[model samples]
Target: MECLLGLLKVKVVRGLNLAICDPLSHSSDPYVVIHLGQQKVKSSIKYKTINPEWNEELTLSITNMMLPVKIDVFDHDTFTKDDSMGDAEFCILDFVEVAKKDLNGLPDGTVMKTLHPDKDNCLAAESHIKWKDGKVTQDIFLKLRNTETGELVLHLEWVSIPGITH
Candidate 1:
C-alpha cells in the first residue's frame, strides 16, 4: 500500500472571499477572527451553517487597519466540548498611506457622487494590486458614512505594502 499526503493552503486578502471545508461531519459552527499585535478582530459577516459533507465559503469585508491577521476556526458540537482548530499566519499587511480625490460626478447630479468615501472602500475597489519582485503599490477606496446623520461624509484612500500588490 502507498501513502498519500494532502496539504491545505489558504491566502487571506482584503475584499476577497475565502472558503474553508468542514474537517468533520459531526457539526459545523465555525467562526474566524483576526489578531494584530495584542488586538483581536472579528469578521463583518457572521453566520452558522448546518450543511454537512461540505465546506464554507465566506466573503470578507475590508476592515480597519489590522495586521498580521491570524485566522482561527472553532467547531462546537452538540455532544462534545467545543473543538478549536484551524490557524494560519497571514502576511503582514499594513496601511501605508491614505489620500482622497473628488467624486467623479457633478455636484447637482441625481445619482449623487460618493457622499463620502472611507479607507475601507478604497481597499475593496483596488483589491487586485500589483506585486512584482516582492514589491507592491496600490490604492484602496472608501466611503465614509455618518452614524448620527446617516449620510455619506467623505471619501477614503489607502495604499498597501510594497509586496502586497492591489
Candidate 2:
C-alpha cells in the first residue's frame, strides 16, 4: 500500500435516466460504488427510483493523483446478487491540476477549466471545475457506459492532508 496523500471527497448527488434493474417493479434501488486503485467505497442505497437523489458523501484515501477514480451504480437486491446499472470513471489528475491553482481572488462561480466529453470519459456534457463555497469542486453529469442508458450527477473535491505535501 502506498502512503496516503489526501482524501478525495466524493458526493454522489443523484442519478438521471438510470437503468431499471428491477423488472417487476419497473424501478431500481440504486446505489453508487467508487474505486481508486484497489480501495473501494459504496454509498447508501436509494430505493425504488430511476432518478434517485442520493446526496451522499463518500471518501477514498488517494495515494497517487494520476489514477482515475471509478464510479459504478448498482441495483440492490434482497435475495440475489446486486445487478450493475452502469459504470464511469473520472480523472482526478485533471481536477487536481486545477485545484493547485491560486483561486483566492477569483469570484465564487468563476470557471477555472472547461472539459469536454471524450471517448476516454463518460461525461454527458461539458464539465467545469471552479471554486464554490470556499472549496474547489467540479460537478459532472457522467453518462454511464456499457448499457442502454443512465447518467450520474457527482460533485468531487480533493482535500489534502494537513502539513503533507505531495
Candidate 3:
C-alpha cells in the first residue's frame, strides 16, 4: 500500500500488481487497460515483448463507489502485417471498497454486458452477480464474441482479493 497527496484528503492505493504475459501465444505482447467507471485509465502495459514475456503491474485506487474494476487485454496487432487479427480479453476483477473487518465476502459480483468492440465501446459477453466464498479467489473466466469475426473468444480472468476476504 502507498499514500499520495490528493486535493483534500490523502489517497491510499491498496491494489495488487497484475502480471499478464502472452496468455494465448508467446509471440504477441499483451495490452492492458483499467476501467474506472466510464473512464478508461490506460496502464503501462502495452503490446511489446521485452524478454521471454511481457509484464505490467497496475495500481488501482480504491474508491467509495461500488464500481467494478475492469481489465481489458488486447493482443498487439499493429506490429503484425494484418491489423484485423487480434484478441481482446475483458475482466472485472473486483469492487473497490475500504478495507473493513466485516467485508470478508465480496457482497457483489461483476455483471457482464454485451458490447460492440472498440476502445470501451461494447462488452461482447454478459453475466449477473453471484455471491461466493470470500476465501476462494480465482480467475473468473468469460467468453465473448469478436465483432469482426463473430467467433467466441476467451477473455481474461478476473482476479479476486485474497487477504481482505475470507
Candidate 4:
C-alpha cells in the first residue's frame, strides 16, 4: 500500500505576555520547539523578555493526518537545562475539514481555503470538494499551559497532494 504525503507549513510567529518563571531574575529567554512524531524544529531564542517575535517557518512531511503536532515553549538556560514554559497540541485533520468548506481555486487550478481566527482565539475555516492538491491556511492563537501560563501565536498552512493514499 502506497501512502500519500502532505506538506505542512508551520510558522512560529511570536509569543504574547508569556509567564516569567524566574520572577526574581531579570527576564525569561524564551523559544519554541515543535514536534510531529520524530520530526522536530526549534525557533530562535529571544533573550530577556516575556514577549518574543520568532517569525520562523518550518516544513514537515506528513504521511498520517490523525497524528497530533506538539508545540512546546521553553526558557533558555545557560547552566541548567531549558525550563518548560508551556505547550499545545493540534491535529492536521482539523484544518483539512476547514479547507473542505471554503474553496478557492488559483490560476494554476490549485484549490485553497483560508481559516480565520475567532474572537475567542479559536480557529475555524470552511472547505469544499476536490481534494487534489488542496491547501488550507490558518492563523491561530494557542494557549500553552503546564503548571504555568503562556500563549503562542502561530500561522499554519496544510497542503494536500493528489495521487497518493495512506
Q: Candidate 2 — worst ten consecutive residues by lDDT sum?
A: 157-166
List the candidate numbers ranked by TM-score, top first. Answer: 2, 4, 3, 1
Give the whole-model CA lDDT for all candidates, comma-separated. 0.31, 0.87, 0.33, 0.71
Cα error, residue 50 of model 3, in Å, equals 15
Instruction: For residues 1-166, write the lDDT of model 4, one tens digit per residue.
Output: 4254677888999888887967777578999988987789888899989988889998887766778888888999889999888877766776656543535554433434443444532232332222343455666677775635667777777666665433
- Residue 81: error of model 4 in Å? 0.8
With a 3 Å backbone cut-off (N, CA, C), the pairs that clash in candidate 4 are 99-127, 100-127, 100-128, 101-126, 101-127, 101-128, 102-126, 102-127
| All candidates in order of lDDT, best leading | 2, 4, 3, 1
Tens-digit lDDT string for candidate 2 (2-113)? 8777777899999999999888999999999999988999999989899999888898887788898888889999999999999999888878777666677778887788
Candidate 2, residue 111: the lDDT equals 79
lDDT of prediction 1: 0.31
Query: What TM value does model 1 have?
Result: 0.32
TM-score of each: 0.32, 0.92, 0.33, 0.73
lDDT for 162 in candidate 3 is 47
> In lDDT terms, which candidate is top?
2
- Tens digit of lDDT per residue, candidate 3, span 46-84? 343422122333344443234454445444454553222
lDDT for model 3 comes to 0.33
Per residue, candidate 1 scores C-alpha lDDT tens digits across 36-66 of 4454554333234422122222222233333
Evaluate model 2: give its TM-score.
Answer: 0.92
